[model samples]
Target: MITIPFSFIPPKILERLSKHFLNWGAFLEKLFPFLQQELGKANIKISAKQYLAMSFIATFFLFLFLGFCLTIIFIESGKVLGGIFIALFLSLFVFFMQSNYPKILANRRIKKLDADLLGALRAIMIQLNSGVPLFETLVITSKQDFGELSKEIKIAVDEISGGVPQIDALERMALRNPSPYFRRALWQIINAMKEGSLINKVIENIIINLNKEQIVQIEKYGSQLSPVAMFYMMAAVIMPALGIIFLVVIVSFIELDEIVVKGIFWGLLGFVMFIQFIFMGIIKSKRPSLLEE
Candidate 1:
C-alpha cells in the first residue's frame, strides 16, 4: 500500500506480489513490533508489512534496471561473469539499504528527541509549577518550538482530544518513544500523577537524573576517544605519510612501471579514505545522546 517515489513497477503488480507472497508477510511479521514502535516515534503512518512490500518492489525494479545496464556493459566489454557478479552484489546491497531505511530514520528521530529533551522538560516543569493543568501544560509545550519533542507532545494531545485519557496517551508515548530519557520522563510523570505526588518535583528529579546520566556518557565517550585518537593518528596520519615516502623512495630505486606506480598510489589513497570513513563512523557512534545546555 506504499507508493514509492518515481516507482517503475505498477501499483497493481506490486500489490499482487506483496499479497500473494506468503514468505514476505511472514518475514515482515517478525519485524513488525520493532518497526512499528520506531515508526510511531517518527510519526510515519505506514504499517511494517506495507513498508516491507514497498522495499521488495523497489529492490526488484532497481535490480532489474541495474542488472540490464551492467549486463549490456559487460557483454560489450567481454566480461559477462564480472558484470553478473557485481550486479547481484549491488542489488543485495540496495535491498539491505531499503529494508533498513525505516530503522535509520527512527534512529535519527531518537537522537534529535534526546537532544531536545531537557529543554522540553524544563518548559513542562515551568508550566506545571505555574498552576497550569497537566493537559494544558502539554498543549502549551506542543505549540512551542521544541523540535521532535513538540511534535510528539502534540500527538499525545491529539490522542487525548480523541477521548483517550491523558495518562493513557502519555503512557502510550512512553512505551513507543525510542529515547530512553524521554520514556523515563514520561513514565515518571505518569507515576507522579497516579500517586498524587508533586509533578514539578518529579520533573526536577528526572532532569537531575538525566543530567547525571549525560555526564557519565560524556566521560565514557572521552575514555573511548583516547584509543580511537591513537588509532586515527597511526592509521590516517603516520602510516599514510610513511607509506607515501617509502613508495617514493622505492620508485626512485626500482624504476617501477608507470601502471604499477599509479596502481600503488590509488591503492594507498583508497586505504586512507577508507580509514577516514571508519574514523568518522566511530566518532559519530561515540557522540553523547544528551540535549545541550
Candidate 2:
C-alpha cells in the first residue's frame, strides 16, 4: 500500500513516468559484469569523456537492480500476479527517477550559470575591450572559478592549447549548455575573427541580450508567484482535507447505509487522487520545459 495516497504535494508519480522513457534506469544492473569486463578492462578518457562511461555504469546498475527485484518477486512472492505488478511498479519508478537525474543537474547548473553570467560577461567585455588578447582573457576567466560558465570556458581554452580548433571547442560547449544562443554567438565570433571582423561591440550587444534574458526570467517568476501559491493551497491542502472531512461527515452524521458510506468514501478517495494528478500536471507545466522529462 502507498504510505501516502496520490496527491498534489509530491511528484513521485510523474517521476516514475520519466523512468519508463529512460529505460537505462531499468536496464543497467544486468549489464554490469560485462561492462566491467569490457569497458572497465579498457583504459579510457577520464574527464568530460567520462560521461559516456558513467552512463554505462548507470545503465548496468539499473538493469541489475531491476532483474534482482524480478528474481525475488517471481521466486519468493509465489503469487505471480501481485509480484508482477510490484515488479512493474518498481521498474517504472526507477526509470522515472533516473530520467530526471540529469534534468535536476541541468536545472541547477543552468541557474548557477545564469547567476555567474553577468559577472563573467562584464569581466570578459572589459578585458576584450581593453585590448587584452582573447586567449589570455579566456585564461583569466577560467582561472577565477566564477562557476559553471567559467569552468566551461576554461575547458574550451584547454582544448585550444591541446590543438583542438577553437570553433569546434566552443560548439561543443554550446551543445553541453543545450543552448542555441551560445552556438549562434560562438559561430559568429569564429566567422568574424577569421574575417578580421571587429567584435567588441558585438560582445557588448550579446551581454545586453543575456542581461535582458535574466531580467525577463525574474519578472516571469515574480508574476507567477501569487497564482502558484494559490494553487498550492487549493491543491495540496484544501482539496484533500475537504475530501476526508466529507467522508467523515457521511460516516458519522448522515443516516446513510454502511454500503453507501463505504462507496462514498471510495469514490471521494478516487476523485481526490484524480484531482491531485491534474493539479500536479498543471504545476509541472508552469515550470521550465526542460524539466518536463
Candidate 3:
C-alpha cells in the first residue's frame, strides 16, 4: 500500500507494471520467506506476492530515473560508467531498504503498543475488580485512547461480538501482534481463564512484572546514554572541528584550485552532517518506548 503523491508515473501504470512483475515477486517471496509474517504483523493488507511485485516495480522505475539523472551529470565530465555504477549501488540500497520497511513498521507498532500496555492492563484490571464482565471490560478498553493497544483490543472485541469465543479472539490478537509483552499478557489471561483463577490477581501480577521490566529498561537506557554521548561528542563535534582545522592548515600549504578547496570543505561539512544524523538516530533508537516523550 505504498503511495507516491508526486510520482512521475500514474498509479494506474504502476499497478499494471506491478502485475507483470508478479513472477519476480514470487521469486522474492521464496528468497525471503519471512516477509509474509512481517506483512501481517505490520497490518499491511496485501499478499506478500503483490507487495513484492509493487516494490520491485517502484524500485525499477526509481533505478531508471536515478540512472538517467546521473548519466546526464556524468556526461558533462565524460564519466558515464561511474554514474551508472553509482546509480546501480543507490538503487540496490533503496531496494533493500524497501524490503525491510515492513519489519521497521512492525517494530514501531510494537513500541507504541508496549508504551501504552501497562496503563491499558491496569484499566482492565480495575474494571474487572469493580465486577465488570471480561467482555465488557474489553469493550470499554477498545473505546479508550490507548494508542495501538486500543486498536488491537478493539479487533478482539469485534471478533467476540461476531460470535467468536472470547479466548479465541484474544488468541488471534496475541498471535498476530508483534509486541512480545502484549502476547505474554494475553496468554497469561487465557491461562487464568482456563484454570478458573481470579482474573484480577493475574492482571495484577502482569502489571507488577511489566513495571519491573520498565524499570530494567530505564536503567539499561541510562547505562547506554553515557557512552553514546561521548561517542557523539567525539564523532560529531570535536572530530569535525579538529578535522576542519587540520584540513585548513594542509590546504594552506598545498596549491589547490579554489573550486577544489571549496568542494573539499563542502564534502567535509556533508560528512559531519551525516555523522550527526546517524548518531542522533542511534540515540533515538536506543531510547526505551515506555520512556518516550
- On lDDT, the candidate that comes out on top is 3
TM-score between model 1 and native: 0.85
Off by over 4 Å in 1: 1-42
TM-score of 2: 0.57
The Cα RMSD in angstroms, rounded to one decimal, for candidate 2 relative to the true structure is 10.5
lDDT string, candidate 2, 1-293, tens digits: 11112123233443343344445423543433333222221211222123222343444455556566676768765765565566557655654454334444555555556556667767888998899988888899998867667777988999989998776777667655633445456666777777787766677877777667656765776687688778767876797788778778766876878897788778767876887787776655455421212
- Residue 42 miss distance in model 2 (angstroms): 23
Off by over 4 Å in 3: 4-13
Off by over 4 Å in 2: 1-80, 99-112, 164-172, 175-177, 254-293
Q: Roughly what TM-score does model 3 have, to 2 decimal places? A: 0.92
What's model 2's overall lDDT?
A: 0.59
lDDT of 3 by residue, 25-138 (tens): 999989779998988888888778877787777777888899999999999999999999998898778778878888888888888988899889999999999999999999
Q: Tell me the alpha-carbon RMSD of every candidate.
A: 3.3, 10.5, 2.1
Residue 89's lDDT within candidate 1 is 85
Q: After superposition, how far is residue 253 of candidate 3 from its true place, in Å?
A: 2.3
Identify the candidate with maximal TM-score.
Answer: 3
Clashes of each: 0, 14, 0
